[model samples]
Target: MAMGKVPGDSEGGDEVGFAEINITPLTDIFLVLLIIFMVTSSVIVQQAPSGGAQTGLKVNLPKGGATDVTARATDMSVAILSDGRFVLGGNIVTEDELKRAFNDAQQKDPDTIVIVQADEGVPHGTVVQVMELAKGAGLGQLAIGVREPQ
Candidate 1:
C-alpha cells in the first residue's frame, strides 16, 4: 500500500492521505510460484514412468554395438527379469498370457515391433523362448533391447 498527501487542499497544513494498493510484491510472488511450478512439473514429467512399458524395472541391459531403435506408439515391449519372470507390456504375464498378448498385438498391427528387454543375468534359453513366442504369434519385426556402451 502507498500513501500520498494532497498538500494544496489542506489550508490548516494538515495533510490528507490517499491509499493506493501496490501490486508489485504480489506480482513477484506469483512469478516466483510460476517458476517453481514450472521447474517441478518438468522434473516430475521426466521422472514419470511411461505407460504400457516396464519403465520402473531395473534391468541391467548388456552394452552392445547394435543400431539404435526408436520406440513407436504401436510397439510392444516384453521384459524378462533375471528371476525368470515375464512382464508383457508392463504387466506380469504367464507364458500363455504372453502368447495371447503377442497375438493381440499382431492382429492389431502386423508391423508392430516387439522389443525384448532382458536382464543381463537372464538365461539365454528364456530370451530365446520369448523370441520364439513372438515369432509364433506372427510378429515378424522384433528387436532386442540393449544399452549403448559408455
Candidate 2:
C-alpha cells in the first residue's frame, strides 16, 4: 500500500489526499445567518401590534362612544395602570419624569397632542395628575383614550 495513494487508484499521483471536510466556512455562514435572524426577530417584535394587554400594563380603559377620532402620528400616549404606575410609550416612568417628558415634547412641537389612558380601577387623583401635567406643559390638544363597549 502506498503512503498517499490507494492501490489500483485511477488518479495516479503521490499528492496528499484531502479526506477531511472543511466545516469552518459552513460554521461561519451559519453564525452569520443566526445573527441576522435574531436582529430581524427583535425588530418584528417591537413593530408588532399590541392588543392592549400585550403592553403588560393591563389598563382597563373606560368605555365611551366610538367617535371617529383618528390618532395622528404626532400623538403621545400615557397610560395609568390600576397599580398606580405610570407608563409612557410602554416604559414605566415616575410622575415627575412623565411631566418632564411632556414638557420636552411640548418644546419640540407646541401643537403636540397627548392622550391619557387611565384604567378604570385607577384612582381619580392619579388620572387628574396626568391631565394636569399635560396641560401644564402647553399641550393644548389633549384627549382621553377609552375603549368602546362592544
Sequence-dependent TM-score of model 1: 0.55
Please give each candidate's TM-score: 0.55, 0.54
TM-score of model number 2 = 0.54
Q: lDDT for every model?
A: 0.85, 0.82
User: lDDT tens string, model 1, 1-150?
Assistant: 344557676556545556666789999999999999998776555332445543443456789655677889999989999999999767899999999998998999999899999999999999999999999999988899988779
Q: Which residue pairs show backbone clashes in model 1?
A: none
lDDT of 1 at 44: 50
Give the range of the ten consecutive residues with the poorest summed lDDT in model 2. 47-56
Model 2 lDDT tens row, 14-133: 656557677899999999999999987766554224543334323467996566557777778999999999998899999889989999989888888888899999998988888889
The candidate that wins on lDDT is 1
State which candidate has the highest TM-score.
1
